[model samples]
Target: MTAQHAAAGQLQLNYWAEARLQRWGHIAVPLSSTRVAIHGGYGRDGKKLRRLDDVVIVSSDGTVAPTVSSTPRPKARERHGAAAVEGGFVIHGGRAGGAFGDAWRWHDDVWRELRCEGSPPAPRWSHAFVALPGDACLVCGGRGDAGDLDDDAYVLDPATQTWSRVAAPAFPVAFACSTSDGQTIAFGGGRAARFADAAWSELALDDATAAASRRLAACVCATARPGELVVAGGVPADEGEVGGVAVLRIGEDVKCVAEAPLDVMRAYPVHAAAAFSGDGVVVFGGGVPCLSFAPVFGDSVRVVMT
Candidate 1:
């Protein structure tokens, strides 16, 4: 990997052959600094996935620093998972006992089960989650029981350890690859019906009833900037697989501006995970609906928006 610092405000960070990062993995954008946290997955190689838990703090000065510790994995036993820490607590989602109902909070290196007063979202994997500035955390769509897809939405509050339902938009929303727009969250993909595809939705926090809309795009991965949401490729119902990319302005129309074909054509299951890092979005490993291709792992990429 080549590391260079320029006079401009942006820091240039790239990983090369020496770092041995075979496939790009899901990324976590931290608020503390310019550092982006990354989690690496292992594919058919039988290698174990690695979580870069220690914060990698990159500064505006173009410096790369790491905070490493010997801390073990959190008390969570799930195999494939996603995690985000906010309000001084680390929240995790994963599979347990053949079900995906597991949720936990980590504090002082120990994880405690978080029980609340409402029904939890159905068991799922490869779910996308983002925490709002307030005490609420929003969980979007994911893969559900019996190899089905789910478009259900739920909210979690750290104060009461409770979950509340968020009404779906007028249109169906599923396979919701999503990210935070700093003020609210934006998601795209399709409805819950198998093989159904639909437009994207910008779920703003200001007005619960005033969700903005976009056009047809089965977005499996998307990243949010200050003013735009760059959605990556996924299979379309008729196309079978897509090589198209689209963008949705925060409150404006959704437009297809750029198109980059995937190195490999793969249909993503609802369980795929994605995150924003560096100057693009990083996607993680997931399966296809009909098991058309072998299960994918250690899959990732950075989609830079022009």
Candidate 2:
């Protein structure tokens, strides 16, 4: 891992952590106090796995520590999808040896089970989900059994403990980076079908009603911001990753404004995570070459848009 300073007086970019198998699966989350939280398993010497049950907190003022502990951790299960919401973070829909469709929330120093009814999403892994500004969450397609892709779309209302079916414009794709800009939900590149094709989709919410209009083609990653959905680095095929950052803004049609204009091209399986910080955006750890089952990059890069 290495450290480099970016731009003027922005945050110091630290990329000093080596990649391990268990560490690669961790996800980066930004805290309310301008710090970052990383949760996962880390490999110490390729021989032992360090459980990342604790949330690592890093601040710009040069403070770092673990906020929570895994000693008395929640139920042991692989986390595939996560989103930071009103109270805390909600983890959903991961697979172990079999598919998992359960939802758990991490808030107030404890993990609580969240139940819903009315046709829940099928047990799936690598499915994409995002919490909207309101009490709504949208989950999309992912890989199912026998290497088949799922095309189901479900909306969970935490306030009502109910689930409802939503229209799926993009079908048969897993590992897509699905996120929202408060109003519209966008999904971008992943293993589309069995052949490893690349594509994108989106759902726009009306100003008055919170109903999603339809799915559109404006792929983005977890690193996207509100109103601005950007695809930093993703795989064009199953073989390798691309360095180009495909960018799109939410408007009348949700069109692509730029492509690969950034300084870096992301590697494959780059499960990038980001959050809004202050006036700009804060992007956390991501993987390379392919979707890493463990955490790879351990840097906190702060992005301030012009």
Candidate 3:
């Protein structure tokens, strides 16, 4: 475990006591400017594998603790999409017993299942979701229940409490990382039909960038600045298992710069990343070394200082 401080070019990583069980496919949504709420994941309690329904609150002030929500909790799920909405956080489709189409809203320290209007997307897992402007959220490609990959997209409006399908992506991928800068949303590498591929896709635009060629699957992405994004911790296409981090600068020409390796080899560490106030990104729990069937778990919290 290392403390928080700046290195010459390397990002600073601070390790703390494990707040919750080491798990993957969990969602972390920012509750406040300095605090984030972490939701469900697949993990083992002792010897049995279980889908967790735990909620842990992580604060930038170095406080990590669990929150006890009111009764009538949502079903334990993993690979779900969570986005901060008007008054609270909205959690959408994920795999519980199977792929789930239900959506839940968390507000005032309580969870309420939402009955939305319009046709919702099919049940899926490991999809990419980004909070859009005007209290809306966009959900993209993932793997369906029948083991088929999805190319469809959907939008959820909080104001109207409705859902609507949107334009599909050229390449349908799952476990990809995505980040939005209000104008455009960029996604990186993910599994297509069989093997993982090096590909990049964008929403609302067709302009491809040079940084799009790097293959990164199951990684976490966050906006480091207004026009720049930081992608960290995932398995690369060429690499056997482990992966590193990179900074994507978006402008007239998008390029990845200031690449660095993480302290430990990790893939699919955090389902969603929380941005630091200054210049860093926080990575929560994820699988380490490799994504094997009986995977080894990682419990440390990593921060990439840009």
* Best-performing candidate as measured by lDDT: 3
Candidate order by decreasing lDDT = 3, 2, 1
Model 2, residue 130: C-alpha shift (Å)? 1.1
lDDT of 3 by residue, 1-306 (tens): 434544334556555446363677788776666777778887765687678887787777657787788778778988888888765788888897689877888876798888899978887777766677676877777767887555677788877889987766566553333345543444544212111122234432222222333344444455546655656555555565444556655555455655555555422443434444323566667763345567666654456554
lDDT (10s digit) by residue, model 1, range 28-82: 3443333344332222223544332333333323354544423444332222334
lDDT of 2 by residue, 175-259 (tens): 3333444443444342121111122344442321111111221123333355554444333443343333444455544445443
Against the unseen true structure, what C-alpha lDDT does each candidate score? Answer: 0.41, 0.48, 0.62
Clashing pairs in 1: 126-271, 174-190
- Tell me the spans in candidate 1 whose CA falls farther than 4 Å from its real position: 1-33, 39-92, 106-112, 146-151, 170-172, 177-224, 242-245, 265-272, 284-300
Model 3 TM-score is 0.80
On lDDT, the stronger of 2 and 3 is 3
Each model's number of backbone clashes?
2, 16, 1
C-alpha lDDT of residue 235 in model 1: 46
